[model samples]
Target: MPGPPRSRVSCAKCGEGVNDRREVISVLEKKLCRPCAAGGYYEPI
Candidate 1:
Protein backbone atom coordinates (compact mmCIF):
# COMPACT_ATOMS: atom_id res chain seq x y z
CA MET A 1 0.00 0.00 0.00
CA PRO A 2 1.08 3.59 -0.60
CA GLY A 3 0.67 6.71 1.51
CA PRO A 4 -0.76 10.05 0.45
CA PRO A 5 0.40 11.51 -2.83
CA ARG A 6 3.36 13.89 -2.70
CA SER A 7 2.56 17.34 -4.11
CA ARG A 8 4.40 20.66 -4.22
CA VAL A 9 2.89 23.72 -2.63
CA SER A 10 4.15 27.27 -2.48
CA CYS A 11 4.86 28.98 0.81
CA ALA A 12 2.40 31.75 1.66
CA LYS A 13 4.96 34.18 3.01
CA CYS A 14 8.25 33.53 1.20
CA GLY A 15 6.47 32.19 -1.89
CA GLU A 16 9.05 29.42 -2.14
CA GLY A 17 7.93 26.26 -3.88
CA VAL A 18 7.79 23.40 -1.39
CA ASN A 19 8.85 20.14 -3.04
CA ASP A 20 7.78 17.82 -0.22
CA ARG A 21 4.23 17.94 1.08
CA ARG A 22 5.37 16.80 4.55
CA GLU A 23 7.70 19.77 4.83
CA VAL A 24 4.85 22.20 4.28
CA ILE A 25 3.22 23.63 7.36
CA SER A 26 -0.32 24.89 7.63
CA VAL A 27 -0.89 28.21 9.35
CA LEU A 28 -3.90 30.53 9.22
CA GLU A 29 -5.30 28.21 6.57
CA LYS A 30 -2.16 28.80 4.51
CA LYS A 31 0.75 26.52 3.61
CA LEU A 32 4.32 27.48 4.43
CA CYS A 33 7.83 26.11 4.06
CA ARG A 34 10.05 24.72 6.82
CA PRO A 35 11.81 28.03 7.53
CA CYS A 36 8.54 29.94 7.57
CA ALA A 37 6.95 27.26 9.71
CA ALA A 38 9.74 26.92 12.30
CA GLY A 39 10.75 30.58 12.22
CA GLY A 40 9.49 32.91 14.93
CA TYR A 41 8.46 35.56 12.43
CA TYR A 42 4.86 34.36 12.26
CA GLU A 43 2.56 34.66 15.26
CA PRO A 44 0.14 31.94 16.28
CA ILE A 45 -3.51 32.78 16.55
Candidate 2:
Protein backbone atom coordinates (compact mmCIF):
# COMPACT_ATOMS: atom_id res chain seq x y z
CA MET A 1 0.00 0.00 0.00
CA PRO A 2 1.12 3.53 -0.74
CA GLY A 3 1.26 6.38 1.76
CA PRO A 4 -0.80 9.56 1.64
CA PRO A 5 -0.14 12.07 -1.07
CA ARG A 6 2.32 14.88 -0.39
CA SER A 7 1.04 18.44 -0.52
CA ARG A 8 3.05 21.02 -2.38
CA VAL A 9 3.91 24.17 -0.43
CA SER A 10 5.20 27.47 -1.75
CA CYS A 11 7.20 30.22 -0.08
CA ALA A 12 5.30 33.42 0.62
CA LYS A 13 8.36 35.65 0.19
CA CYS A 14 10.03 34.37 -2.99
CA GLY A 15 7.15 32.25 -4.31
CA GLU A 16 9.50 29.30 -4.67
CA GLY A 17 8.03 25.82 -4.66
CA VAL A 18 9.20 23.68 -1.74
CA ASN A 19 9.26 19.94 -2.40
CA ASP A 20 10.02 18.79 1.16
CA ARG A 21 7.87 19.67 4.18
CA ARG A 22 10.95 19.62 6.43
CA GLU A 23 12.49 22.50 4.51
CA VAL A 24 9.49 24.78 4.99
CA ILE A 25 9.64 27.54 7.58
CA SER A 26 6.48 29.03 9.05
CA VAL A 27 6.65 32.70 10.00
CA LEU A 28 3.78 35.05 10.84
CA GLU A 29 1.31 32.46 9.55
CA LYS A 30 3.15 32.46 6.22
CA LYS A 31 5.23 29.68 4.70
CA LEU A 32 8.77 30.57 3.65
CA CYS A 33 11.64 28.62 2.06
CA ARG A 34 15.08 28.29 3.67
CA PRO A 35 16.77 30.97 1.60
CA CYS A 36 13.92 33.45 2.07
CA ALA A 37 13.77 32.65 5.77
CA ALA A 38 17.54 33.30 5.94
CA GLY A 39 17.20 36.76 4.37
CA GLY A 40 17.43 35.29 0.85
CA TYR A 41 21.21 35.23 0.62
CA TYR A 42 22.70 32.91 -2.03
CA GLU A 43 26.39 32.06 -1.76
CA PRO A 44 28.51 32.29 -4.92
CA ILE A 45 28.94 28.89 -6.58
Q: Which numbered prediction scores highest in lDDT against the true structure? A: 1
lDDT of each: 0.73, 0.70
Q: After superposition, how far is residue 22 of candidate 2 from its true place, in Å?
A: 2.9
Instruction: Give the poorly placed runs of model 2, Cα more than 4 Å off.
Output: 1-5, 40-45
Give the local distance difference test score of model 2: 0.70
lDDT of 2 by residue, 1-45 (tens): 267537668788877887648355565778888887776566768
- The TM-score, computed over Cα atoms with residue i paired to residue i, of candidate 1 is 0.56
Candidate 1 residue pairs in backbone clash: none
Candidate RMSDs in Å, in order, are: 7.4, 4.3
Residue-level lDDT of model 1, residues 1-45, one tens digit each, is 266557877889888887646565475778887888788565769
Residue 19 alpha-carbon offset, candidate 2, angstroms: 1.2
lDDT, model 2, position 16: 81
Q: Count the backbone clashes (under 3 Å) in each candidate.
A: 0, 0
Which number leads on TM-score?
2
**How far in Å is the alpha carbon of 45 misplaced in model 1?**
29
Model 1 weakest 10-residue run by lDDT: 19-28
- Angstrom error of the Cα, residue 10, model 2: value is 0.8
